[model samples]
Target: MTSKVDRPPTYEDALQHPKYEPNQLHPGSVESQPPSYSPGSGMYSSSPPSYWAQAGMWSVPDLPPSGMPTAVPTLSGGLPATNPGEMEGSFSSQWETTSVRHSFIRKVYLILAAQLTVTFSVVAVFTFVDPVKMFVIKYPGIYWASLVVYFMVYCILLCCKEPRRRFPWNLVLLGVFTVALSYMSGTISSYYETKAVLLAMGITAVVCVTVTVFCFQTKVDFTSCGGFLCIASILLVIIGAVTAIVLSFHYVPWLHMVYAAIGAIIYTLFLVYNTQLLIGNRELAISPEDYIYGALSLYIDIVHIFLFVLQISGSATE
Candidate 1:
């Protein structure tokens, strides 16, 4: 009798045959293949086909273990493996903050430039033009009246409904304030000789530009001395009042020069302080929302600086 040889079970035969489970023991299979299914097999022993069974046992080839990393669970919206939004959110927040800060600074400087231009133009017109000069000189009280109007308009803008304070209203209030300030500045400039006014303006420009450049370049923060500046400003105001009273009694030339010198120094310091406030990245950073306030602060500083320079130059000529 001829012996019948059983070829190693093919994968197709393994799939079709009920006795060829991957986990079961089979006598003719390779060591990696599980035994054939039998009556004694446990009901829970079913699993995926073994490598040796999937390939015919003798035909199974050697392969190196896979080097690729397993897939990591992703976030919703197709974001990366980590919480994902945290990094993007942080970057966007920083970009927005930087953009707002720069915009605020630009708006403040532009408004200040407009205010200065208006002041200079009004002063020039009133000083040089006969009709304007005559009108301003005839009604000196116009300056004081404009000041009152300015205060009222400013207060209304500050205290009124949000809608009233927006758009054309905010712009109108600012324009009114600027016009009032220009009138007052023009009236004051008329008191000085034309040459003295021009010289004072040039000097003021040089000093203001120099200090502004210094503030931008230097690491030294002038805002740190806020308390000192406040106290000094108060003392200067008292000194100015006293000086005014002394001048009313009798004009002391040396005292006038001293007063002008002191005023210039104080206002220069104020310029430094306010520029620091505008540009500094501190805890008390000027809010982008407060562009009007920022412009107001800088405008006051420059105007005072110009006034003191005029006083000094006018007194020098005398």
Candidate 2:
């Protein structure tokens, strides 16, 4: 039996004009098409078209639709895209803020220095001057009066921002508060031996210096410790009340000493916290406008440290 071969068709085996363009040549056909021939020798070429000016071809950028900023990473190997004019203004604003903070800190410290000077001066005179010492020792009522004045002024400064920020009046109230605190400190110092008082002063100075330095250098964020410190302050007050009540019946030397040491540590932390608040650049910072309040906070911290240190020393000596 003979079999037919399944061979593929080749170009040579096909007839010419096999595209079947029947409608293209028909005049009335709606699907008319173009002819690749020239009627009167209008020339045609296979070259690509060209334009006078063309946009650049770039890949899709890894950026938002708003276009990429001129800014570049500081450590990266790219030139900065910031405008020169903008850079100067940005730097100026930052410098201005920094300068304001520095001046604010300087003013607060000056006020604090003056306040501490008045305080220690009063303590010295009260301790050394026999007549003044005897007078303060005789009239404990003055100490109570100082307490009242200090509290009233403290409340005014704390609650009334206007008064704290006021010009001459702010200074007046601050001086009054400082003097009242000085008297209270002086009276307390008068009750202790001179050597004990001096030792306490020295210890307090060292602690304040050390705490302030630590606050400056350490990365610890004490501003968030506000709530904790507030609770601690309340607890310390409660402890003070209990100590007063307990000592009314029995004088426990060790109890008072322990309380004094604890008070010292707490207030030392307060000094550190407040110092960081004043220094700025923290999570919580005191406004530069509140110089009076800043001074008062720092002064209070140092005074409490002195008071607790004095208590510890006086108890030891006695």
Candidate 3:
């Protein structure tokens, strides 16, 4: 006995059958066609072809004369429909997330500004005020002592538990740290003439702003090279230490200038790297919750850049 295989109906085959019901195309299909009705039946009494046509299975311009179904039914509810509050809720959530990230960035920058203000204010006092100048000059040991103290407090804050690392406490520790750092900066600034110090400050400001804007607008992401940047920074620090010791012993006239110029370049790269960290989104992003840490990292980068620029310009004048 020979058996015939049933083949699936094509679009042309569906077209040839005018009285075709959708169930006829499927095996064990349960759906049935609507009952016979008079012309008085409302639009709601539409058969499958009329229903699919109105539901936009195929465009009116492209549909055949029979208004044949063009798409397979996939939606459980048939026609696509929007839920009552779904769009509004989705927009609200997106807006809230965007606002939160912006707010976090703003808070971090404001804190950084306040910290800069404190450092510069202290620098001004030590540079201009005779009593403060005389005291720092008379007792040079305070510079190293303040350096040790600042790092001790910095280490404590870094090691603190989550509960202790929140707002006011973190801010307080940061303020103390800024004060300590400024004292060291002020003592260092006292060695240079007033005009040299001001010039260095101007140069530092220009370099910092230029690098910051570049990081913000550039398409080339520096965050990816974070490990390379970190290794470069350590190597620069070692070179700086060796250079400082050598320069202190003998006058290799051009050595200080070369070291200062290289140091400035290294810290400029550091500024870019840390700025990318602050504007967090990349894989190396610092958590938004670590606003204090972000600010602190940026503060150090800016201060180091200032120190290098001061050394370069200050040495030139001398």
Residues 1-318, model 2: lDDT tens digits: 423443322333322334422223345556533222222333221221121012212222243323335654586357656788999999999999999999999999999999999999999999999999999999999999999999999999999999989899899999999999999999999989999999999999999889988988999899999999999999999999999999999999999998898899999889988999999989999999899999999999999999999999998888
Ranking by lDDT: 2, 3, 1
Residue-wise lDDT of candidate 1 within 1-318, one digit each (tens)?
A: 423344445566665678655554557756544443322432223443354355533221254224425566655568545545887998899998888888878988998899899989998997788788888888888989988987787676556655233777666777888898788788888888888889888998999899989988988877878888889889888999999999999999788878878888888898888877787475355657667767777777777778888887888887
**Which candidate should be chosen as best, given lDDT against the real structure?**
2
Order the candidates by TM-score, highest first: 2, 3, 1
**Per-residue lDDT value at 309 in model 3:** 82
Model 1 misses residue 105 by how many Å? Answer: 1.4
Question: Could you say which candidate leads in TM-score?
Answer: 2
| Displacement of the residue 161 alpha carbon in candidate 2, Å | 0.5
The local distance difference test score of model 1 is 0.75
Name the lDDT value of residue 275 in candidate 1: 79
The sequence of per-residue lDDT tens digits that candidate 3 reaches over residues 63-114 is 4635555667667586576675987898999888778777878988998899
Q: Which ten-residue region of model 3 has the weakest summed lDDT?
A: 37-46
How accurate locally is residue 168 in candidate 1, as Cα lDDT from 0 to 100? 71
